[model samples]
Target: MSDATSLLTVLVTSPRLPAGLMSRDAWTALEAAERVLASDLEDPLPAAIEVSGITVTALPYDSPAEAARALVDATRSGSVLWVGSPDADPGLTDALAEELTRLDEPPQIEVLVGSWDLPGARLLDAVAVMDALRSPGGCPWDAEQTHESLAKYLLEEAHETVEAIETGDTEHVAEELGDVLLQVLFHARIAADEDPGFDIDDVAGALVEKLIRRHPHVFGDGDASTPDEVERSWEQIKATEKADRDEDDLLAGIPVSLSPLLIAEKVLTRAARRDIQLTYDDKADLGTRLLALVAEARAAGTSADAALRAVLRQIARPATD
Candidate 1:
C-alpha cells in the first residue's frame, strides 16, 4: 500500500484570460509537483503546460469518481498537480471529497488559483455577444438595427434608468443601467459595421481621454478641492478644448430636444460658468418662472428635473379608492 500523507494540488485558472498566463505561486506549485494529471489532453491549459516541458498525464476514466480515485492514488507516490477544466472541473471536487472520506488517511488537497479575471474582463463577453447578434447568422432584429432605428431606445433606456433610480430599487436601477449600456454597445457595434474604422474601443478611448483631460485634480497637478471647484475646472478645460468654436454661444452644444426644464438648467449652468448673470422677473410668465425655479434649484444644489419627476411619480401612484 502507498503512503496516504501525500499532497494533491488542484490548480484553477480563469477561462476569461490566456491559458499560460499563471501567477508565480501557481507556476511554483506546477514545477514542484512530482506528477501532473489532467482529464482532457485537448484543454488549452494542459497544452500550455506541456509547452513548458512538464509531462502531463491525461486520465482515462469513465466518471468524476473514477478520476478522483485515480488522482488520489497518484498522490500516494509523491506530490501531484491536477489541471482543472475550464468549466471548473464540475463534480470533481465533491467526488474527491467523498473518495477521501473512505480512506483511512487521505492525501492533503490544496487548491491553487492559477489566474484571475481582471476588472472589466466580463465586458469582453458582452462585446462578443453583441458581435454575434449583429453577425450574419445571428439575431434578425439585431442585424437589421441601425443607429437611427435604435435612437428612440437610447432615450427610453435613459428615462427608464432615471425612473428606476427615483423608485429606489437598486436591482431595477442596475437592470435599467444595463439597458442603457446595451444601447451604447449596440450603437458602437452599428458604427463599426457602417463606419468600418470606429468601434467600441474608439468610444471607450475617447471617453477615457476626455475624463483624464477634464479632471485635472485627479489626473494632473491642477487644484480643485470642492465639488464646485471641480465643476468650474472641468468647464474651463472643456472651454479651452472647444476654443475654436463660437465663444459667445455658451449654450451651443446643449441639445434643443431636451425638456424645457432640462434646457433651462443647462442654459443657467453655462451662463453661470461664463459669469453671465441671467435676470428674471419675479412676476413673469409660467415658462420664465419655471426657468427661475430651475435656477433656484441649481443654487440649492438640487436637480429641478429630478424634483419634478419625483412629484409626478407620487401623483401618478395607484388610487387607494
Candidate 2:
C-alpha cells in the first residue's frame, strides 16, 4: 500500500475558457492544486486560472524528457501537479509514467480529467460512430454503401436542405444540414476502405487548401475590394489551377451529369466569357429557344436551374381550401 504523502495526483484539464465553461469538479481541482503546470507559457489557461487567485507555473521544458524530469522533481514535495491539456503533448505523460516506474518509491500517479469537452466537440464522436458502423462486423446496410450507391441519397438530402432553408424553419434546416453532412461522412468512410483510401481529414484538408488558394485576396497578395472583384479573382485563380485540364475548351470542366438548365447556363456563361456570341434564328428548334432563355436568365443575374425549380415547386403545391 502506498502512503498518501508519497502519491501525486495530476489533474488534466482542457484549456478552453469562459470560466463558466469549466466543470465544478475542474474548478475544485484548480482551487486545490498546490502547483499548476502548462507546456505553453503564453497560453490563456494560466491567466484564466490566476483570475481566481490560483497561481499557475509554466513548465520550463522544450521536450518530453525534460518535461517528465521537471514533473517528477515537482511531485517529490508531495504537491499535486495540474497538467493543462496533456493531449497537446501525449508523449510527455508516457515519459512521465516510464520515469516514475524506474524509481523504487515511485509516487502513486493518478490521472483526473478536470474539464469536459464542449458541445461542438462531439462532432468527433459522430466520425467515430460512422467508422464503427462501416467497420467489419458492423451494420449490414452501412457496410454495403458505396459512393455510387449513396449518390441518390446525397442529392435527396441536398434538396431537402434547400427546402428546409426556403421554408425558414431553423430546426428543420439544422436537421436537413445534418443529413447532408452524414452523406459527406458516409462517402468519406466508404473511400477509407480502398487500398489508397483517404479519410475525412483529407477531404477537409483539400477543401481548406482550395478555399485558401481561391481566396487570394484573403490569404495571398491579391487585391479585391468589391464582391465582383473577388468573384473575378476566384475565377482567374480557378482557371489557372485547371490550366492543364482541357484548357483549350472553356466548358471542358463543366460536369455532364448537371441538370439540362444548369448545363445550358454553364455553356452560355463559358461562351460569353470567351466573347463568343450565341444567337437562335426563327427556324431554331425548341431546345435552342430553351438555351436562349437560360442565357437571358444568366444575363439577368438569376440561376436558370433555381428559377425553374421555384416555378416547379409553385406548380406542385397542394391545393388549399
- State which candidate has the highest TM-score: 1
Which clashing pairs does model 2 show? Answer: none
Per-model TM-score on C-alpha atoms:
0.88, 0.62
Q: TM-score for candidate 2, please give it.
A: 0.62
Tens-digit lDDT string for candidate 1 (287-321): 88888899999999898999998898779985587
Cα-based lDDT at residue 190, candidate 1: 89
The regions of model 1 sitting more than 4 angstroms off are 60-70, 102-104, 318-321
> Each model's RMSD to truth, in Å?
2.6, 12.7
